[model samples]
Target: MGFRENEINGINDLNLCDGEQAVNKTELIDHIATSADISKAAAARALDAMIDGVTTTLAKNDSVTLVGFGTFMVSERAARTGRNPRTKEEITIDAAKVPKFKAGKALKDAVN
Candidate 1:
């Protein structure tokens, strides 16, 4: 099913057809505000702070673990040779650090 911007009132209003449903930042903030009995602005600030914390930790090549949620860390990728899809030319892919997340057992269990 297709989703409309106006159709979303909160998380529960999502239509999960073939897992196509998604919760956008605004919707999440709304949910947080209602659940925490806070204002939307406060909820947004809290969400932004949490994201900033995770990003800052990952930038230091460290991991942030929320016991019942998940762990976010940075993983290094080795430089490798790859072929360009359009030109079929060989190119070297540079090594880099990328952020990764591993769901905790509690989160996994909640999903299941």
Candidate 2:
């Protein structure tokens, strides 16, 4: 049942710096597996589920809030006029619903 045992072992072998190094998807999956005591495949599925749920909720004009983590929501932007830098042509920027996130108090506190 150690389908990802080799990958996990490889991740553990790498020396990761706190803030100096960028952690990629593999590292993230490895972390999830170790922290949740689940298989890498399960962790990947869980992450995918979370992403899909957030995207679906936002598409419905709703938000997803992980109490101690953050909130994912769609914010509206008003139509505005803008100028193109290269051609210096004026343009109308259409209003749209953009995704946003605000970290929760716990997450903020944890970082600081």
Each candidate: RMSD to true structure? 5.3, 6.5
Top TM-score hit: 1
Encode model 2's per-residue lDDT on 1-39: one tens digit a residue. 112222343343233564545567777777788867899
Clashing pairs in 2: none
TM-score of 2: 0.80
How many residue pairs clash in all the candidates, one count each?
0, 0
TM-score, one value per model: 0.82, 0.80
Candidate 2 lDDT (Cα, 0 to 1): 0.80
lDDT of 1 at 105: 96
Error of 2 at 95 (Å): 0.3
Worst 10 contiguous positions by lDDT, candidate 1: 1-10
